[model samples]
Target: MRFSVFTLFPELLRPFTQEALLGRAAARGLLAFDLIDLREYAGNRWRKVDDAPYGGGAGMVIRVDVAAAALESLEAVPDEVILLTPAGQRFDQKMAEELAQQNHLALLCGRYEGFDARVETLVTREVSLGDFVMMGGEAAAACLLEAVARLRPGVIGDEQSWRADSYSSGLLDYPEYTRPAEWRAQAVPEVLQGGNHAAIERWRRDRALERTLARRPDLLATAGLTPQDSAALLSAGLSAEQLAQVGAPPPPRKSRKKTPAPAVPES
Candidate 1:
């Protein structure tokens, strides 16, 4: 996949794409990055891309015309253009998966107060990392890039690794243990060390369920639980009533209404 990042601070974004898994992915030809400096597209001699808000706002707003020019200057338009801002729709694992399938992605990073309102019209989607605000969109763009990039084929060495990631299965990840099974008086779980694949898999699933139910029960509402999963939760001490509260359908109950007693005899 190819990603084009339009940012006033290309230096801030360059190092990240050149390091870690992203760098390896680029080197292997699994992913590509193009950093388009927004400042270079500024019309003024001073290379000014932002100015005081039209109605006298506190901080400068990125000019709509300059941003538009930058978008137009791209040799080949991207499949999707994303604007990073606080007001955008919340970016999530689902969106990352969706974006990973795209042939090309363009991320537009805003600085100062934000992009001009008109600039939003040109983008396909607007995404925000979360509820919090940041100094600039560069960080958010990097985050989105990493999230989407890792999902690309061959980008991550092991495909199964990402499948087990938290939120990927709509459940928190199962706890993992390393060497030194006995450390600081803490021993690894017997199930993990037992070498029984079936038992180990069951243990991991139950722990994932337990952790998600305890920490982020909201995820269970749409986690696509199976009969076996329900059984696992029940075996882990979750009552049917409690499971129902998390959107698990309760088992059917048989009615026991008594038959009318001998009314014909009294008549």
Candidate 2:
């Protein structure tokens, strides 16, 4: 996938893409980046991209003209031009999967108080990391980039890892242990050491259910559960109301293992 991240501080996002999994993906051509500096489109000697709001706001607002110009500079039309803002849709694993399907993407980083409201006209979508605000969209852009890039083929180096990831299956991830069997008086579960695949799968699913129940019970409303899984959870103390909310597992989406990346569309 190709990502054009438009930011005033391109250098800040460079090292993030250059190191870790993103770096490796770029090396193999599974991912691409065009960290275009937004300041270049400022159209001024000082390259000013932001100005005080017309209504006299406390902080400056990114100019719509500059942002639109920066987006127009892309060589290829992106499937979507994502504008990062606190008000956009709350991003999730599902959205990440959807984005992975698109071959090209442009991320518009907001600075100061954020973009002029009219800038929305030029963007295909708006995304938010969460409820809180940030100094700029560079950090949010980096986060969204990494999550989507890893879903592409060969990025994580393991297809199964995607399937078992938290929220990929509509449940929290099971516990994991490593190294010495016994550490600090804590011993690895015997089910793991016995090499029983079926038993291990059951153990994992059960643990995942337990964790999700104790934490985000809300996820169970849409999470697909097998008869056996429902039975196990029912036995494990899922109440009647939650059980009513449970649904049969939806058909699994097609896997994106071929080509350079898969969406895991973080679905």
Minimum summed lDDT over a 10-residue window in model 1 is located at 246-255
> How many collisions between residues are there in candidate 2?
7
Top candidate by lDDT:
1
105-198 in candidate 2: lDDT tens per residue? Answer: 9999988899999999998999999999999999999889988998888899897898788898899999998889999999999999998999
Clashing pairs in 1: none
What's the lDDT of the predicted structure labeled candidate 2? 0.88
Report, for every candidate in turn, its global Cα lDDT versus the true structure: 0.90, 0.88
Give one digit per residue, the lDDT tens place, for model 1 in 1-267: 999999989999899999999999899998899999998999989999998998785989999999899989888989999999999999999999999999899999998999999988999999999999999999999999999999988888899999899999889999999899999999999889887999998889889998987888889888888666787778777888888777776544546999888756655
Off by over 4 Å in 1: 235-237, 249-267
Model 2, residue pairs in steric clash: 97-265, 97-266, 98-265, 152-261, 153-260, 153-261, 153-262
Q: In candidate 2, what residue range of length 10 has the lowest lDDT sum?
A: 245-254
